[model samples]
Target: MTILIGCAHGTRDEQGQETIHRLVEDIRTALPGKEVREAYVDVHGPFVADVVAEVAAEESCSAVVVPLLLAGGYHVYHDIGEAVKDRADVVAAPALGPDPRLIDIVMDRIREAHIPDTATLILAAAGSSDPRSQADTEAAAEMLRARWSGPVRIGYAAGIHPTVDDAVADARANGEDFEVAVASFLLAPGFFQKRLTESGADHVTEPLAPHPRLVEIVLDRYRDAGGS
Candidate 1:
């Protein structure tokens, strides 16, 4: 069986870490008898390189490192890619984002938040310096806009503008007089998700975590990499 290594950008929040771990467990449940291991790229132990090294040493097992990130960033492209560089048996999978099922989950979370139809949505994400990452986020915004008739804007948590607060302020200043809502594009309840609350929006949706679609995406990524 091919070993699936679930890699994520770790968080300091206890629940955030637990969320990733639980997601990995869910993957294990979905793929019984396959070794599913959890790993972190930052802010935690059990790094990707170590996991890849250990799994590569195992007998008769190929490893696939699937990132739990939303887009291709430094961590996914550089950190993860470098981990399994020389390992013949290990493959790095693409980051999960800009997928239809994920968009469905985002819509579900927005509906659950009771965001009114007339509201302006700010799709807030943890920013990345990588151009590809920003492009992926822009693509996600376009996808959301296709389903939502109201105004939809993209905002960053750390690296880029307009920030969430700025997006909210822009919405308020608009002549349409729409109610402002923030769609948290984060994967879990971590520091970045918490920043959404301070965005001054009328409503903020919950982060996408432990969703069944996430498991599907993980599996898809692994499969796309030709991992058994």
Candidate 2:
């Protein structure tokens, strides 16, 4: 069996756990024949290494560790990659960010949130200490800014530059009654999402969950990875 592992940067919130579980179920439904497992990098149960070891031991199968993260960061390189190191049967796929489809998703969120050109939009990601992660978020923000026709700022919930509060403050200082619409650049609702909401932003968009388009993206990645 081909084991498709949905790896999340785990959260302490129970609601976050539920959201990831739901996504895993949707992923399984998308790839019916494949066995799916949800694992976390930290702050929750079933670390990626343990999950890989458990599944590889039981099934002697090829494992695909798909990060539910927004960009290539420490978790992608160190944690998830390390998890698959001892397991010859496992391969780690790219993080679920920076894909062209994600641009479309961001546009969708903007439209759904009814953000105006006057609105100072913040693409708030669960930031990383990794510079690459911040850069990726900026790249994604640039893509969105191209199509958005508005001031789109890249902000982080934690870790690095122009944090949510800073984004809001900067926009406010710019002298417009900016509508702070949050495009959650996260795969699931977690502490970051909660922080974004509590950050007193004017509006918040939903996380990129198991939307149909996202399911298609996951399946496409599996195919691209040479999965059957």
Top candidate when judged by lDDT against the true structure: 1
Question: What's the lDDT for all of these models?
Answer: 0.90, 0.80
- In angstroms, the error of model 2 at 206 is 1.8
User: Which 10 consecutive residues of model 2 have the lowest summed lDDT?
Assistant: 218-227
Candidate 1 per-residue lDDT over residues 1-228, each given as its tens digit: 789999999999999988988899999998877889999999987999899988888898798999999988899989999998988889999899878778888999999999998888899999988999998899999999999989899999888888999888877777758688999999999899889988788899999997999999999998899776
Candidate 2: C-alpha lDDT: 0.80
Per-residue lDDT of candidate 2, residues 53-103 (tens digit): 887787557878888777988999999989888777788888776777888
Clashing pairs in 2: none
Native-structure RMSD, model 1: 1.0
Clashes of each: 0, 0
